[model samples]
Target: MQAQSLSYYEILHLPPPPHTTPTISEIRKAYHSALLEHHPDKSILTANDSSTPTVDEIVEAYNILSTSSLKVLYDQQLESVQQSKKIEEARFKRLIAQADSIDLDDFQTATSCVQHSKDIFAESSSITLSTGYARESCHGYPEDTCNLQQIWFRNCRCGKDDAYLVTESMLEHAFLESDNAQSDDRQILVQCSRCSTWIRVLFSLAE
Candidate 1:
């Protein structure tokens, strides 16, 4: 299905405001205005059309955009859309790994390969690698259970097996690494001194 096209600010018809935040009163006012304009009952009566969206739509939109937790979810949805094009392009490039048609077993293997590549490249000063994977598990028992995984990597060593998991913190670290490695041949391997599950880094020299 095509995703919804409403952002928090757009839902409330407000300008793209700063993260400094708005007060509850301001939120409520914006919500009420949106409700008045879009409530299906009013629209149907005035426009004599059954295709108008219902009051529930307005309520749901307001609930999502006005509350802190819901607002965060809405913001994430927006971000997902904004990043979707880049994600699709990356996925297309990895078509051979059938990275687009990966299974659970392949996913785990791909993740390990990608992580390994990132670790190796992260030791250099001129290049860097970042990897990420995301997967969702099925809801059934042992036999029926399964997971769908999506992997992504960037600026790291590109190899047949190098596909990694994606995470919010990883993205932030990658950005920081990119910034720090701009002028130096310095390599930084940001790995867990313990489990070593999460790794992000920049490098200047060969692995």
Candidate 2:
């Protein structure tokens, strides 16, 4: 499925000419001549079939060297090959210096630090928060009638009588609280202690 690299001379199976670059016309001529000589369709009736290459092979070779982008890439590859010895020499020197300084103790220290970080992360891998509310009334001046008056907070924290009455503004505040705290890996539930109403807050630790 992937195209293979080929040099211009290799594609045409020709010897490289001395101090010369072939023109586009010369390249085209060489391609057609090679194809006519070796293409499977042309060689099917020839007695020397063993010497001929396949049509696909000839087409693939021509397709690469004939295109400007592909030819440029091939030339660049050739340049890289010519420079590879120098590159490898530099790399070998750097590696020797690194090898001289690297030690097993340093590797162990890095591994331990990574494991410690992972352990700290595992402590609060996930958290859940939820909230709900309930209403209650006490006997007062309007004793005969039941009122919808209610106290609200995050989760039930009874006996303190510190729960605030729910209002439009207070409800908005509670929603914001949950939204702001959702990103932490800590569970915080708030509710009216006396009314047994509550809200859950979920948060997670940063990665």
**Best lDDT among the predictions, by candidate number:** 1
lDDT of 2 by residue, 122-195 (tens): 44343111111111112122434332322222212454332422333333454456655635433334444355
Worst 10 residues of 2 by lDDT: 103-112
TM-score of 1: 0.33
After superposition, which runs of candidate 2 have C-alpha atoms over 4 Å from their true positions?
1-6, 14-18, 44-53, 82-207
Q: Candidate 1: lDDT of 48?
A: 44
Please estimate how well model 2 matches the true structure, expressed as its whole-model Cα lDDT.
0.45
Instruction: Please estimate how well model 1 matches the true structure, expressed as its whole-model Cα lDDT.
Output: 0.46
The superposed Cα distance between candidate 2 and the true structure at residue 173, in angstroms, equals 92
Error of 2 at 159 (Å): 81
- Residue-by-residue lDDT tens digits, candidate 1, 37-129: 766555556344334434565567667666788777767777687689789777645543332222222222223233233333454433322
Supply candidate 1's per-residue lDDT for 66.
69
